[model samples]
Target: MTKEHILPKWMREEFPELAREPVFQGSQNEHDGPTPDGPRTVYRGGKEESGPFNRQAPVVCGPCNNGWMSQLETNVHEPLSRMIRGLPTVLTSERQAVVALWSAKTLMVAYRAPHFGPRPRPEVILPVDAERLYQDRALGPMMVMGLANYQPTPYAREPLYVQSFTRMEHEGGAYSYCATLRIGHFAAQLVRCPDGMYPPLGQIPPHLVLLRPGASAVHWPPSRPIRAGAEWDSFVNLPEETGT
Candidate 1:
């Protein structure tokens, strides 16, 4: 029997809506994909594996927040369970040809476009303000972050549902995926000051946006699109590597 895992409670309380979004749902495990390409499946480390980023057992969690969403750490567990419960048991070649292993880790999220058009795609795993969470030290011995989905966008032709880090779900207002994904193109900071320590201003890196823009220019980089030949693009970034 494979192991199973669940999603965190904060996420369940944070986002009350979930659905399948299969944009790049491809798999290397299926033998019917192309003409037999040698031996696709392999047994390594004394275990049978499927493909790169091979499915791992999940840490499934909850039917909380009125059953809007549930989470799994990975696919090795419930994906198969879901597949089994959602399909027929009778075996057939057509079904075999279409057989696929679910990768809960590869679960797709619907990111509704915000003010920015052309849309943005984010990594499945989310980031959090670990330092802040750790500062309290009581939140948990460890800190982890999560993403939010299923927000209705007002600017698009249809209400957009995006994956983002800014929505305070219970508050009833959310930062749409459009605006959320855009804020990721520049460098960021993870401040870990010990209550009463400050760093010199001149040594700071140029790309961080303050979450709350009050007095100063809110000092953070604004998200923009790739100008066609940029080397790389990602949201998770480190702030200026100034004073250690």
Candidate 2:
């Protein structure tokens, strides 16, 4: 009944990969992709340290095709009921509200302004309702969906990618959840490049963000009045008994 549980649908569908990757907020706040021939100089704690010099580096100076930048393209107001009508599972209208709210909130967080350089430039323009994402209590909450090991861009240290419980952003402050990643593996570039530098668009290592790793890891949550995970039914099981 508290604010955190009242999220919308956009949050779910858009930020579906939440708590799946190693998410870093301002570490790479520079979403302005660099020119293809660009050379990035990162300091690994001084001492004449250096990292990979990929001309493929993106610039935080301007918006690029990073998937995170496509937030504005998502249909936030779309009804989850209509989206899930064909499913065999059962959900309530009130729960549907929760599902939609969750989804909306997810998308907003995903669409949240991608790191812009020293100025005001958002790589991901965010949903059309940018104002509402932050203002709406149901959508106000935010969470960083990533594996602890998922390294943040521009940082030399490799993310632990270990399973752990982190804070969830809501109106009140932060909340904790027992989360683990289910995205076993993906056809990502799999480059062993030293830390930082992830694709700005689409699921790079497109994997699952499970509620619990190993045991009950899955793509969706249990059905209430609203539903999610059904979106991932094709990839993971969405049986009501399965909790989605």
Candidate 3:
């Protein structure tokens, strides 16, 4: 296995400020049994002192890391950098697909990466999802991706942050998983459900623009931007209530 940096080299080189700051890595695992309210969730994991540039995970093999994953990063460098820096840019349908795939890939790596304290239980992105992503280099039909602009506050200024949530039906069977990734002013959320169980698009908040399963071009910097702290918390946790 090879160690893959959680944040790509291009990203670190472009944003030195983020590369220097210490990152806080954490994970939360939730499980709802077959019975409606049987054991809910236990939040595990803690902070790590490493910066985003230095945070590496020995999850992927050498060939995979140097092959398609490398190409994927290269493909996303230009457009993603612009988005993260809040520069004006339009995303064509093809660009949208690339960004969506990159977002999902990043989330998958973060989920597989090690965290401080105990490792969270019940995998968020299943093995099947990972295999499909690796083979097709695209998000599966069961996955939906959304993008939004993020407004950082003085108290909560982290250039790159990722958080994931998984709801389990039994002990180890996951029903749904949602991962939200924020880089500077750009934010993307990827939600995955079982086959034939896609979430309703109408329930998504107006601030988040649908990226995957969309064909037309998308304009950058949406009219509404999600504010840091409480607003961000609400946006990431909204799937619990709205089923998206």
What is the overall TM-score of model 3 with all chains considered together?
Answer: 0.86
- The positional error of residue 177 in candidate 2, measured at the CA in angstroms, is 29
* lDDT for predicted candidate 3 compared with the true structure: 0.74
Reference-based lDDT, each prediction: 0.22, 0.25, 0.74
What range of 10 consecutive residues in model 3 has the weakest lDDT sum? 165-174
Model 1: which ten-residue window has the lowest total lDDT?
22-31
Q: What is the lDDT of residue 71 in candidate 3?
A: 91
Instruction: Give the C-alpha lDDT of model 1.
Output: 0.22
Candidate 3 residue spans exceeding 4 A from truth: 33-39, 155-159, 168-174, 202-204, 238-244
Candidate that scores best on TM-score: 3
Which model is ahead, 2 or 3, in terms of lDDT? Answer: 3
Q: Over 4 Å off in model 2, which ranges?
A: 1-88, 110-122, 133-244
lDDT of 1 by residue, 1-244 (tens): 2222222333233233321211111111111112333432211111121221222232222332122222222212322222212221322322211111111112212111111122212211232322222233111112111111111233543211211221111112211111122111211112222213343334323232232211222211222222212211233222122122
Tens digit of lDDT per residue, candidate 2, span 102-134? 444433332232221231122222233445543
